[model samples]
Target: MGLENVWVATLTDGLIRADYIAGIETHQTPALTGKPSRWLLDVTLTVSAGSGTKDSWEVSHLHRTLAQTDVYPAQAAEELARRLHRLRRDGAAGVLRTYVRYEELSFEFSYFDAGEAAE
Candidate 1:
C-alpha cells in the first residue's frame, strides 16, 4: 500500500461543499496534490446519516462528477452524495447500481424533504 495511501490533497472538509454543487460551475481548484490521473473518486463512500429538507434538498453533488472530474476534489464528495441519497431510498441495491455492488449498506441514512418555499 505504499503509493495507494499517499494523500496528495484534501478535496472537502465535509460531505457536501455547497459552493461546489452539481450546477453553476463547480469548484475549479481541486485539493490537487493527489489526483490519481484517472477517475477513481478519491474519497470513500460514507453516506452521511440523514436526508433532505424544505429550504433546500439534501442532494449530493454527484451529477457534477461526470463532467467536472473529466474536465474533476470533486471525485469522492460527488460520489458520496449520490450514493447516500440512493441508499436512503433504494438501500444496498441502489449503491450497487453504480459502485460497490452488494456491500453492506450503512443504515446511517434516514430521511429527506423538499424544504420550505420562500415568497
Candidate 2:
C-alpha cells in the first residue's frame, strides 16, 4: 500500500500512546552579525486524531528539525527508531490485548480515478 497516512506513538507499559502530529517546515536567512546565515527546520507535532483503542496506531505521525543542531537530528532519529521497535515488539510480546497509538499530521492525498487513464 502507498503512504496513506503516518503516525508516531510513544510506548508505556507495552502500550503505545498517540502524541502529536509532526509538521516539518524549512526557513532560510542571509548572513547576519558578520556570521553566515543558515536554514532552520521547524517541526511541530500536533494531535490530530482523537484517542484510539490499543489497536489503533495509524492515528499518529512523525517529523523533525533536520537543519538544527546534531542533538535534534539524533533525538528525532532515535525517537522514530524506538517507535518502530515498539511496533515489532507487540508481535513478539504475544499478548492477547494489543494497543498502538498514533499522532495525526498533514499528509498528501492521492487516489486513482476510474475516468483517468495512464499514458
Candidate 3:
C-alpha cells in the first residue's frame, strides 16, 4: 500500500490514533528548545478497509528535544512504521497502542493489544 494508505490503515486498525498525530501547532517548553525543536508534519491518510468496530490506539514518547541533532520527524515516522509492522505480525484484531522511547540514537517501542476491549 501507499504511504498515505498505510498510515490510514494503521490508524483505522487501531495501530495508531488520530489524536496522537500532531497537527500544525508547535510547542516550545523549557525542556524543548533550539532549532528542529518545534515541528509538525501534516499527513493525509485514508483507511481502505474498516474493522467494523472501533479500535483504540495511542502513540506516546514520539519525539524528544534533548536527543535530536537534526530534523527528527522522519526518524519518528520510521520508528512508527517499524512498530506497526511488529504489531501486524500478531494477526489479532483490536486496538494496538504503541509507545516509542529513545535509547541513545535508536528508538525502542512497546505495544499493547487490547483485543475485544478496544471495541
TM-score of each: 0.21, 0.26, 0.30
- Assess the local accuracy of residue 44 in candidate 1 as a C-alpha lDDT between 0 and 100: 28
| Cα lDDT, model 1, residue 12 | 37
What would the TM-score be for candidate 1 when compared with the true structure?
Answer: 0.21
Candidate 1 lDDT over residue span 60-92, tens digit each:
424322222443333444454654444434322
Candidate 2, TM-score vs. the true structure? 0.26
RMSD to native, candidate 1: 17.0
Total clashing pairs for each candidate: 12, 12, 0
RMSD of each: 17.0, 17.2, 12.8
Whole-model alpha-carbon lDDT for candidate 1: 0.32
TM-score between candidate 3 and the true structure: 0.30
Compare the candidates by TM-score and give the number of the best one. Answer: 3
The whole-model lDDT of each prediction reads: 0.32, 0.34, 0.34
Which stretches of candidate 2 lie above 4 Å from their native place?
1-18, 47-66, 69-119
Ranking by lDDT: 2, 3, 1
Deviation (Å) of 7 in candidate 1: 23
